[model samples]
Target chain A: MLMMGAVGLAIARIRDLFAVSMLSGIFSLIGAAAYVVLDAVDVAFTEAAVGAGISTVLMLGTLALTTRKEKLGGGKSKSTTAFLVVAVTGAVLVYGTFDMPRYGDKIAAIHHHVVPRYIEKSGEEVGMPNIVTSVLASYRSFDTLGEVFVIFTAATGVLAILGRARRRREDEEADEGGSDTKGAAS
Target chain B: MMHRKVVLRVVSKFLIPPILLFALYVQFHGDFGPGGGFQAGVIFGSGFILYAILFGVETVKRVLPPWSTRLLLVVGVLTYGLTGVAGLILGGNYLDYNVLAHDPLHGQHYGILIVELGVGITVAASMITIFNVFAGQSGGD
Candidate 1:
């Protein structure tokens, strides 16, 4: 967490977009390490892969298309408003954590719920030793299906936007070809 | 593109196969271990992305074209949905693995395996597709 904070600070202070992107990737790697400490291996794996790896690559790609250096100053009022929003959100989140059960409490509301049943019966019912797999793949299969569809939609949306841009460029080239022929005839 | 780095090129060539092997291991071993379709898919996709970075997108495209990626995406989803449909056809609830095989335990095993494979395929294809599209756009290719 301290490492994440330092990386975040570095990212905020950096004016070079490329450096900021690299710092954010470092932040994600730190966050994934934190997740591993919390025993959420699956979430950690995803954070490492998607946040640190894929997102870093994507951000670098965007940086290549845009400027490497960030523009100086968006005005004091904008900064003040952003600070205010962050402060308020952070306060609300901290406040909300007060009502939560203490970490690793066996008798917590969540642990008393369907978790016990899942823990006890998943092996017999789903036949998977890894209860997480049984829960995610069988017990909550519909939700996983929905998640797959979401990914599919997102990929389709990206393809549509990028592919259309390429097609438009091709059309412009075709139009320019006609103009080139007319100029030669003249 | 790091094409000039001979060490990177050779090492990545050596690493890609093992990365892919680990992905398949995670995909199939989720029932017993700490991984599943999602992580496996990401690992698989990362291998391809690594290949693209080291070798160039043109070479990767030759190995796995855009059309095949699109097809795999559809096939993955279809495989998942059809597995559910198969459950229904066998006189069980939608997505219920009980009827997938004569024995309930074996059915659950089969069902989870098949659906996990589906998830892995879709995820890997989607990641590759998105990467290709983004790379192509930025490269203006």
Candidate 2:
């Protein structure tokens, strides 16, 4: 947590976009470590792969397409509004946490419900030793399918937007060549 | 950019196969271990991305062309949906794994394996496709 906070601070202070991206990657790696310590190995694996690996590459790709340095600007109103939003959201979340059970409480509301059944019968029903996999792939297969569709949609959206730009450029170049040929022929 | 570095190239050449092998391991071993389609796919994609970085985008594209990547992306999703459809056709509810085999337990195993494979293929293809698009854009610009 301290490492994450330090990385966050470094990111905020860094004006160089490349450095900031690298720091964020470090931040995610630290977060992944934290998740592992919390015993959520699946979450940690995802955080490490998506957060530190693909995201870092994507950010660097974005930086390549754009600029390495962040634009320097001081917008007092924007900063004030952002502060107000963050403060209100944090306050609401903190208030909500007051009604929540403490971490690792065996008698927590979640543990009392379907979790016990899932833990006990997942092996018999789903026949998987890894309860998480059984729960995700069997009992909660629908949700996983939805998640896959969401990824597919997101990838499609990205391809459509980026591919269109490239194709448009090609079409314009072709148009220019056609006009040049017409002029020469005429 | 690092294509000129022979040391980097040689090391990556050595590294890429193992990375891909690990990805397959993770994909197949997820039911008993700490990985699944998502992580496996990311690992698989990263191997290719590493190859692209060490070699060149054009080289990687030639190996796994954009059109094929796009096709695989669709195929992965289709594979998932078809697995569910097979369940329905076999007199089970949507995505119900029991009917996937004669024995319910074996069916569950087969269902999970097939779906996870679908997930792995889609994820790997999607990541590679996204990377290719982004890299191509940067190069074009």
Candidate 3:
């Protein structure tokens, strides 16, 4: 927990974009560690890859194209409404946690019913030891498909942005030489 | 930028392959472990992101062209969608492995392999695509 707070502070305080990105990666790894400690190995793996790995690259890439330092002095005043809303939401969540299930409680709804069957029989049924895998690939295959599409959509969006820019660059270069040569020849 | 260190480059060269290999392992070993398509995809994507980080976007683009990545994105979706479609044609519900082959176990093996491959491809490409957008932004320093 201390490490997580420290990582958050490092991210907020660092002026360098690269350093900020690396710090965010550290924050993500911390989250992954938390998930692992919670016994959610699948979630831990996802957080490690997405949070620490891909997210860092994406953020750094954005930094490469933009200013590293934030605009120091030009932003509008903070909105009190936004602050109050966020505070209220956080408080509500904290309050709601009083009703939450304690960790490792055998009576928790999440640990019982069809899930337990999957956990116990996945090894024999799916011929695999990973209950998470069996549940995701076999019991909830549709969600897996949806996730793949989500990635596909994101990839397409990026390609469209880059493609438009490349085309503009080519057009500019073509006109640059043509206009100069025509002016000279004429 | 030129004055910046090349430490990322050397590190990426070594890190990218292992990251990818680990992704593959997670994908295939999931049935016997605690991972599957989503985890594998993210791990695979991270490897490409590492390449982008170390070598820079230009080098990463050269290695995996935007067009190829786009193709992969489409292919991954198609592979998964088609597997489900195959099950439907075989007189079963969507993604039902029982109809994929004479033996249910054999069909499951085939289905899992195909779906995991799809997940890996989509993940690797999407991650790189996100990185491309970030790198394409207007200011590095």
Candidate 4:
């Protein structure tokens, strides 16, 4: 929670894209660690790698093509409105938390049902100790396929961005050559 | 050329290979432990990140040419998608591992391995390529 607060502060205050990227990566890693502590290793692993590694690189790459520093002290002020909204949201969240389960209650609703079946039978059937692996690769393989699609989509986006610039450069080069030819002909 | 940071330079040289190897182990050993293709990919990607951080993006690019990165990225996606298609052709459902080999267990093993490999390759290349793009844009600016 403290780290989360620090991350929010850093994201809000930092201006340098690289610094912001590093901080956000830190924030993501922390989230992964939090997930691990919650006994969700698979989710933690995904969160750590995708959130911290790839996302940071993508955001930084985009920032590199654009402005590193945002216009400070020139944007319109929304402090009062933002504060009121935040206050209301915080109050609601806190209210909701009062009805939530206590940490690490073994009999929690989440611990019931088919998960136990997976945990018990996965090793014998799949010969894999990690039930998460069996679940991800065998049972929920389609979801993993979807995840691959998501990655491909992101890569395509990056290629499109880079490709646009290359095309623009080629157009400019063609224009320059056309003018040179016209000059020679004239 | 700027004077290099002694610690980061030496550390990266020794650290990058081990990190990559570890990533492979994680990918392969995922069936037994707490890792898989995605985690392994990031760990492998981190090797390139270390390389880029220590030696500049130019050196990293030279080592891993952009065309190869793009190729690997495509190949990874193809590898994953094709494994599923292969399963389908074998008369099972899409990405059904039971159809991969004569024996269902063996088929599952083969299918999982190939799919994970594809994932790892895509992950590592995409990560490095993303870094390269940013570095290029930043340098140009």
Better of 2 and 4 by DockQ: 2
Q: Which docking band does candidate 1 fall into?
A: high
List pairs with backbone clashes in candidate 4: none
Backbone clashes in model 4: 0
Q: List TM-score (chain A only) for every prediction.
A: 0.91, 0.92, 0.83, 0.80
Give per-residue CA lDDT, model 3, range B51-115, as digits (tens).
66556678778888877877878888898999999999999999987679888777877887788
- The CAPRI quality class of candidate 3 comes to medium
| Residue range with the least summed lDDT across 10 consecutive positions in model 3 chain A | A71-80
lDDT by residue for model 4 (A1-186), tens: 589788979898887777888888889999999898888888898798778877787777677667787766744458667878999999999999898888887787787877888888766666677888888888788898888878877876877887467668778899999999999999
lDDT of each: 0.90, 0.91, 0.76, 0.82
Error of 4 at A34 (Å): 2.2
Q: How well does each candidate superpose onto the true structure, as a TM-score?
A: 0.95, 0.95, 0.83, 0.85
Candidate topping lDDT: 2
Q: For candidate 2, what is the interface RMSD? A: 0.7
Model 3 C-alpha lDDT per residue in residues A45-97, reported as the tens digit of each score:
88887788667766766676666876554334454676688899999999998
**On residues A59-143, what C-alpha lDDT tens digit does candidate 2 reach at each position?**
9999989899988887989989988999999999999999999988888887887898998998898888888888888888899
Rank ordering of all candidates by lDDT, starting from the highest: 2, 1, 4, 3
In model 2, which residue pairs have backbone atoms overlapping below 3 Å?
A: none
- Pairs of colliding residues, candidate 1: none
The regions of model 4 sitting more than 4 angstroms off are A14-18, A45-65, A74-77, A97-100, A173-186, B139-141
How do the residues A1-186 of candidate 1 rate in per-residue lDDT, one tens digit apiece? 987888888888789999998888888989999999998887898788878888888888778767899899889998899999999999999999999999888778888878889999997888788888899999999999999899888888989988788889988999999999999999
| Chain B: TM-scores of all predictions | 0.96, 0.96, 0.86, 0.94
